[model samples]
Target chain A: MTDGILTPDQILSAAQDVLRRYGPAKATVVDVARALGVSHGSVYRHFPSKTALREAVTQRWLDQAHAELATVLASDAPAGVRLREWLGALFRSKRKRALDDPELFATYVSLVTESSQVVEGHVADLVGQIRQIVDAGLARGEFAAPDPAATARAVFDAAVRFHNPAHAAEWSRPGIEDDFTALCDLILLGLEVR
Target chain B: MTDGILTPDQILSAAQDVLRRYGPAKATVVDVARALGVSHGSVYRHFPSKTALREAVTQRWLDQAHAELATVLASDAPAGVRLREWLGALFRSKRKRALDDPELFATYVSLVTESSQVVEGHVADLVGQIRQIVDAGLARGEFAAPDPAATARAVFDAAVRFHNPAHAAEWSRPGIEDDFTALCDLILLGLEVR
Candidate 1:
């Protein structure tokens, strides 16, 4: 019950619950403290300000989004297949969050909009995963990219329609999966040629 | 001076002025008519309803956006050069709109959002142009796409952040042109491997 015993991780966990229940605009540090059965000061001790807490929550959500895809990225599969799977996993993770908990995902989207640093960090993380795949491809002689990082970014940009949150409204359209496959095939072919 | 004397093109030209001034939300059929110094009835005669008029205006904007690129599309240049020029033109057109008259570009973005049909038609036109170059590439054995239309859409989607209004906020970032070049090079490389 003491502030000394409470940890930042516990505060973050409770904050996520409060966020999901009330959404971003209505959720507050007090609300998160209430969810944790702790005093507001206790919560503030862990997070310097509400904005820092919100950014941390956004970073947490982003981390969760990439967690599954990280497995695919770390897998021993062929780099090309791993690249495709990584992208597919990324899209599925986001789509799942949107479909399974629309409110939470929407809240996360709003929070992300407010935290550009979190977004930049999240993007850097995802692109780094992509770079790993590109590096693997280069090692296997399957890709001829002169710069793996740049190639990873191009692949990311190419797949934005399928994975970018901005285009979420269009993802449910008919033939989207087919379009995703076709696009991946095209990009992979491009990578194969260097 | 009469309804019979005012052509639809004249009405649309005036409507664009109204839209640029008042934006999509406040712009009206009355405003368009006022801009042309004609009765609303004449405007209605050309466009059955306000929605129809809005759609037509959007189409007009899209047409103007593509006019120069259409020339590039119809050129006798190599398909690769045409494709690169076509994408470059499209990006330049959008960037020019965003830079020259951000208010108008923002208004057009909202108008396009409200009129999905107009957006779909515009995309189809752009993709169709892409398909033409893709088809030519296929014929010349510069591309190995089995379905030019699908590949065309892939290319269009790949370069979306540069052209799509949704990401207008990020377009102003420095090094955008370099990013565009890197992406185009990647996709072009992809398309080259039949």
Candidate 2:
């Protein structure tokens, strides 16, 4: 491999792959270095430690999620349609990633609880996007919520809770998504054109 | 202690304490026997193995939760009021039991995933109770929705999600119960009249 300068994005991509393969606990800096065919010193120069590497990987995942969500939200669709489609996409992505790679999913859930700052930052951004949508809808008399921020948080929380595979087996039978969509519809109903 | 005849309830109570203290992995038949001041043989007579004892403890916990909910529902209060009051009580109970007793909670959560029958039984009972309230409100033309069962499930899911300390922190700021009350008020708003 050429000794060309490795970009932070490349390092982040490699770190994500390692984390997806081995859990955060087992994914070491040396492992990432080995994956990149680089020296431990080279990986350390960018990440400092395993914790730093894990944080970077988590941030990268969040960044990607945000970008994907932005694309969906910005699509030329009605607010309700966009919201439902975005949630369906998000849930599907989470399900596929979790089923395809349990280790990474476990590590991400652990990080959400352990690294509050990183998780909170990501949640704040997601919540902000939801608030913006809700606010715009309310302004146009398309929704009727008194507090868009709280409603947005509730919507996000419900989506996360409903889509969790651990809870999925409990909620999702055949046509389970229908029930979830109905719930979202009711929440949106509370904010409907009045 | 006398060599008294122990009921299944007695056995479960002793096992619950042991599981809460030592966790399912560490709480063996011998440990539970010792905690109950009974012979290991006695415990073995009731539950052939540690797994059996743990299952009994979990079932007992679910039974207790169901009993509490039943009592609330059987009260003369209006359906909406009954639900809100019962849900708040349930949230407090779950938080105290689940968080304060992590070992027991871990065992319960793990057991639900491992044994779908156990989770299904509990979920069925919970859904039934929720359906009763939602149906009652709908009969009175209080709620606007046509699907009472789905609405009930959403409320149940929301309550469970809110019971998690981390998630509840989002709304349980200073005077946050007011927010929760308001949310509930909105949910049951049209479903009942003052």
Candidate 3:
């Protein structure tokens, strides 16, 4: 209802809705503005370009992921439980997003490979957070691994690799999650000293 | 060069060379014929269509992989060593194909997903071969796990996931093969009981 008082959050929420409906490739700024019931110029006022709008949408997703992880990390649950829950949530969320808006998911994955410094920074930050958890486990003698960072990287890569859209069709078969959990448990077992 | 008695192996060889040079998407029967210094009509004499030629090329690769696995399994080496070598060869060959001819690699990957029956047959055959090795190891107490079929599927899926061209840049990093070996070691460690 407010013309000039629309917040960035409002803009991003509207953009996400448009993304879900039309996908990232076809969701233009004008379409987003139309969905928001606002003038096309108002969308540009918040996001300078379509790429910026798409980036914001991706950043919002990442922010949500970080927020979820923070909640899990703050809980009284054991580190192993927290880590498993976090990964499960991550996988489910990615799968949902992929199914809801494949174009956006494809764009996000492409960004991971594209030589973009900003995307690399975001990825590195996420990796660093996972590494911290692994390091904490190793410090308490909970893990037997010599290289916590490497193990963390491997786990992160495995989770993402398993959830890839191309892999997901077959990977979504019966007992797939059970198999994934088994793999994760194996990693944890390997990290645990006898 | 012989017009009247071209073997299937020779046809496949010519196709592979053409694929390497022109990529899977651009490689046509005419191109394969030109590469072999034969008339297009002669090429058509052996293969009915471009799709048939592509299938022949893929089948050739599959045969090579099967032959290699057979040799590794029949070797007198220890199971663990055999597994490591087999996985190393698998990963290396996939990486080489992805880098050397990305279009063809993409086409092959697409083919697996394009038809469920085709992929199921391919997976079944591959799993059967790997299961034999795992079964032997289990009988000898070298492997502690019993579900060799499922484990074989996981290994094959992981290899496919890791060797994706999308991940090639990451895999090209120094000591990536070492990282993959570490991952394999983790899998092996998890397979062992105790």
Candidate 4:
């Protein structure tokens, strides 16, 4: 493809592929350009530096989960059911990526470590989503949280291991599913109206 | 002092000091030996290798917390109060290490990464302590848990960010104390008999 034909989206897609194949340490903008049949300059035009490229890809990867969780957030189900679904979906989505899509997941993890701001934004976004869920639960009188925002953050902190990429190593351990369930069960119990 | 003047406990103390001063990458058996006025060979005779020394230091650091927490565990206080104190003390101990003792905390984090088994044993030890607390709560009809062991593990998992070395960077953030309290409040609510 010609230089002008290379869009940021196209570059990001190819960058993701290159990152997955070579891992973050080895992958470069030049490799991404090579995969896309474009000059490295073209890729640079879209993303000022390789760091920007990696950050964009990490953002894109997390955005997929954001969208997936958004569905659970907007569902018509009761707050308790929706909260349960949200927690399970978040855990399952990450666990699946870690176990079944190992390469891309590894790439995502590396990109995340390099892009602290991106990870921070992703975490804030996830916390905000939880806030909305808590708000809904409170509005429906299904949950009791004296401070919804703090409750939201507390909930995320409580369940950090199951969904945080840093804890991915523990996901595949035997009985982790049970552990995850038990933790979530405790969290949900904590959130319920008592 | 003779060559056999050194004991593993003494060597571990000197190693911990060296690790705190220079960090894991820079600290070595030689530094610990020099601190003790002995040859590195003497330190090796007790610790075997630098990795073993690091692990021993890490274990020692954790053992301090274990001993402190064991007091809370063995207290005649009600299970709810003991659990609350245990969670708060655990968080406070780690948070203090991360914020107040910067160098040693960094060394501990690095040593933890190198000494997974030691960390695992510490976690299991903590969970076992939590189990005893849960068992007391169950016996006194102060808590409701289908599986006491799972409840203990879940409690540990819930407050992991407060104590886990991986989250040390977040220890000094503004409002973190409130976050810790909020999470513990929620966790205590979860453990309550409703």
> What is the C-alpha lDDT profile of model 3 across A1-194, one tens digit per residue?
55678788988888877876776557788898887788878888888887787777777766764566676666656556666777776677666767776666676665443436656677677667667667666776666565667777666665655544555454547877766765566555555555
Over A137-189, each residue of candidate 1 has an lDDT whose tens digit, in order, gives 89888888876777888888888887778888887788888888888888888
Model 1, position A102, has a per-residue lDDT of: 79
Q: List runs of model 2 lying over 4 Å from the truth.
A: A44-50, A163-175, B1-4, B26-53, B107-114, B163-186, B189-194
| TM-score of every model versus the real structure | 0.95, 0.83, 0.77, 0.86
Q: What i-RMS does each candidate reach, in Å?
A: 0.9, 3.4, 2.8, 0.7
TM-score of chain B of each: 0.93, 0.76, 0.75, 0.91
Candidate order (TM-score): 1, 4, 2, 3
> Candidates 2 and 4: which is better by TM-score?
4
Best TM-score among the predictions, by candidate number: 1
Task: Pick the winner on lDDT between candidates 3 and 4.
Answer: 4
- The value of fnat for model 3 is 0.16
lDDT tens digits by residue: candidate 4, B152-175:
999999998988888888888888
Q: Who is ahead in lDDT, 1 or 2?
A: 1
For candidate 2, lDDT tens digit of each residue in B116-176?
6777777777778878878777676555666777777776665555554335334434644
What overall lDDT goes with each candidate model? 0.85, 0.68, 0.67, 0.85
Give the CA lDDT, 0 to 100, for residue B85 in model 4. 95
Q: Which pairs of residues have clashing backbones in candidate 3?
A: none
Which scores better on TM-score, 2 or 3? Answer: 2
